[model samples]
Target: MSRKEDGTLVLNKTKIFDTENCYIYQRGGTESKYWQFYYWDSEGREGFRIRKSLRTKDFLIAQSLAQREYINIRAKIQNEESLQTLTVAEMTNIFLAKKKLDISSVPHAGITPETYRILKNRCEKLNNFLGKDTRVDHLKRSAFKEYEQWRKDGYGGKVPKTKTTIKTELSTFKSIIQDIAIKDKRVISNAPDIPKITIPPSEDEHRRNHFRHEELRVLIGTINEWKEEKTLRKTAGLHRQMIACAIELMLNSGIRVGAVRKIRWRDIRVNPKDNPKQQKIFRIITIPSENNKTGKQYECNCEIALIVEHLKRISRFNSPSDLLFCNQNDGKTFSSRIWADCWNEIIKRSGLEEESGRRFSYYSLRHTYATVSLANKVPLQLLASNMDTGTKYIQDHYYHHETEELTEELNPIKRTRKMTADEMLAQYLPQKI
Candidate 1:
């Protein structure tokens, strides 16, 4: 079979439904095997056309599939629907690519990488429940309501999603459709409204997992021991040291992992008035807007200058431009896998996982900082400013720790000495007199 100038084979050309504009054929080159269908839509949009694979080799099956596609296209045109077709998964990929680029190029104006990670997870869940292949234009508002039910029904597991979790996921999914698919890409005509989820009062008060004082001691000790292992290779030992420094930095400064990864040596400044050896103002860490989760530049007085000094001594890439926490091999920031694996191993070795009865991740250090600060009577506004969050958030999430710290003060039992049972009974009987 000879190929046409457009690279399509003319040998397999067959007109469908005896129409001049519609036909089925095979292409040359890499697309030579599968049969394809083409429809010139003169009635819909000017010069509008559809070219898709029938995904079949047999002429009979190709003919059937092409006819079905042609009918569907014609019906969509008659109903004044969009001819552009994009699958849910394809739309999500496009949105995420643009989002990632925005985060890198305009970090202050865009969402944080941590927030992007959560959004990506929600999009994955949407893909799984609604199907990856489902067309964006074909989705109805009712599908989202069905999705709410599907999530409530244990999501095909023993534990169902909480109302708050479902609400957030649905809200994110809706925003992706409205902001990305419809408004940005113009793939879909309109966005479907997601059904509202009724979130009840949360039963679990302690949402943020944090390390106790003893657990922190054990964790730091474990990190120290892990880094000093005699069997560790040079590069491995250096990497563990970096991890140790990162953990201590977070515990001391309450900075997020995302922000910490972007830190450089130039961001640190020693207080001129205070001595580095014995000083109240040890060092100031300037978290730039681009690196911060809240996208605001702020300075924190931290006690991790010694840790930074140790890192500077060990690291070969200790230049001002190099990342503070980086891989020794490439002088790049540690990969997520490496950071997570090291954290998990440290937690296990510390015995904090079993002793604390909580799942501890890198973020737990931040929570621990908040709880400890609250316990130490750090003013709410000041702590919030230092942590790059609002006072209300701290009060809502971490106030329980403060209450525990003031247990005796908040509920004092006034008794000079232990009274006998008869004295207690006499006080109750003669209270009116």
Candidate 2:
């Protein structure tokens, strides 16, 4: 007999039958009431079945699934049938794959696999912090707050976690959970909102560690002395030359180290081509929009001519395909770690610390460049354009007005000689009286 012919089934009463070696059931009240379909093993054992609700009750929609389940139960033992289950690892992989696809299609895909790796590491740490058996449903906003506190307590020698980093990682985790919900509809039953992370204002403005002009002079002197020494002949003079060029370029152009390493011979060009003097002149280094971090072209001036000369010297020994500065061991582009090590060694030899009480690295050179340029009264807008960064960032980070200049500007009088205390007092008090 058909399920419609059966008496109306309310919340407690359900219409049930054994058919095709399986027990089938339909639960509903009257025609107006919602219905659901369920199935059990032919041997009357517990097995997988759809939940009773409006989603499964409509026979016109669920008849096919109901029939298929009955057929499967008859053909195979209920215990032998496989059921679908989604794991956290499986969900994470699926989420990352979808993220990759989305990033690839974007016009400016700032997200990279490295960024994904960092986010994944943070999630893994959070999972570990929650313990191994924690399920996706266990994640809540309060748990994230605890994680933030743990990070602030110094999880791994890093300073307190920045709100931006925390927000980004949590957003990635939220995306993964949403993906899981899409695949397994049951997961949508409980989804928690991600908490907002607060960023504290930075206390110290001068985070940049850079060399003073006098220290730079000493460093240059030390490099020149080392170049002239015969004992260091086996070492490639290329390191010294590269450091000199790097310092000069950073000081003059303010382009990042990544951009410097990627510069090509063709990118360096002079305008007014016909004039002999102008043709030889090194006026600008044009970084193509693709290689630049801002995805815009940058033009640096003749002050970078020193770097151009170094590039010309290096080019003679290598092809155009060769990087501007490369590791001798691997013949690959210079990595940041290697650059840092080189910087440390140079600083030690140059006695910069003893003289200035400050240790400067490659980035410091860039800061010094900007600071000196600002001190020279270079226009802010012009400097910003040359640096290929925002004018606001320059003003906020690099520009520091020298107090000496302000002092001189405010005081117009220049005393030729120091007056006696009595004379100074008389001059100051008696003029009006």
Candidate 3:
């Protein structure tokens, strides 16, 4: 068959489906003209090909039916596509490609950059367990447990992987396999069911506490010192300075690292709602769904205007296309995922690297922001909205009051500009709605 430039398809002898290895056939003698469409049936590998009768002696009618059936097969292959069609490795690659696409662009399923990193890691685990080339349709659904056990055994049962770790790996494996499988009906049931492995509460990692004020101070001061030191000593300091800016940004506004890394100069506004602009206070940072984890674009009133100003002044390129905190060495975007060396090192240097107590990472900065904001009586309802997190989460997790005396320092006498519910909706929402 030939595909015309005007997008019309022309039928040719023998082959009907362009993508598949399909062709027309006839019984015994050519004179009989009992035409039939013979195509390879991949439904299971039990049979080599399926023979379907076009039920017509007329050549034109047989061609028409062949085209119709060919189209139907092509649609199924398309819907169940795995590049050249239905193999584990090709499908996994496609799935990861889609996730990376979602991470970089809009109209995504909210897979964060961190989540994409994890997905790739999970794919590796699956490949190690089952060879990447294994046909997805060939596996028995119950064999998932055999995989769970195989991971639990962990290479001849010597260096046993953690129960939590093994569970996560197999569960992710099952998810990727099942997602591709049943979406196009590789199996009968509501997807091939993977048996649930019990993850005991005792084995779960605890929720973290926010960084102490002193720890935050030390970290920031140390980073600032790194930035100001002499030229030779300040080589590594450039990256640290970027880290400090990222910390300050997240500390004032609870935007995650995944979202923060994508923020370009064009996304910021220095108090656009205020006349003459208030440089002393936080302005605004818009986190759109393409970068943000929540998959929602929203405004954040943040004190990072000063920080942003400093960054632009020091930045090699201050154009709208340039990122806020890029790699100091190469001026490229940092991190395959968060927790670049500087963050962990700084936390360790700050002496916040706890052995048993609450641990702090780059995410701790966000938690610290929420904790400190709540302590300042920033209004819990508004804080949750501003953070783009749940009010219930704030109440349950981050609402521990530090001290009553510390709260008195704010002295509610000074007027503050906080957006009311109606005002917030008016600003963030489209008026056409």
Candidate models: Cα lDDT each: 0.79, 0.60, 0.68
Spell out the clash pairs found in candidate 3: 282-302
TM-score of 2: 0.58
TM-score of 1: 0.65
- How far residue 120's Cα lies from its native spot in candidate 2, in Å, is 4.7
Kindly report the root-mean-square deviation of model 1 from the true structure over all alpha carbons: 9.0
Candidate number with greatest lDDT: 1
Candidate 3 lDDT, tens digit per residue, 50-166? 566787878888878988877776686667632223556766786788778777455355565667888886777666665677776556656566766776566423343346666
List the candidates' TM-scores in order: 0.65, 0.58, 0.61
Candidate 2 structure lDDT: 0.60
Off by over 4 Å in 1: 1-84, 112-130, 137-167, 179-207, 229-232, 275-277, 348-359, 380-385, 388-393, 402-404, 407-433
Q: Which ten contiguous residues of candidate 2 have the minimum total lDDT?
A: 40-49
lDDT (10s digit) by residue, model 2, range 1-433:
2433336443433333435323334455445444454554324233344444445555554555655654654455444333333445555655656666654312156564445556567657545555545555535546555666666676623643245656666676666666564334233334566666765554233446555666668877876775455545433566556656776777677777657767776777666553666555555778777666676777876466656666666543355566666655555766555566667777789877666655466777778778888878889989888787778888787876667667655664654556779987887784663
lDDT of 2 at 302: 46
- Give every collision pair in model 1: none
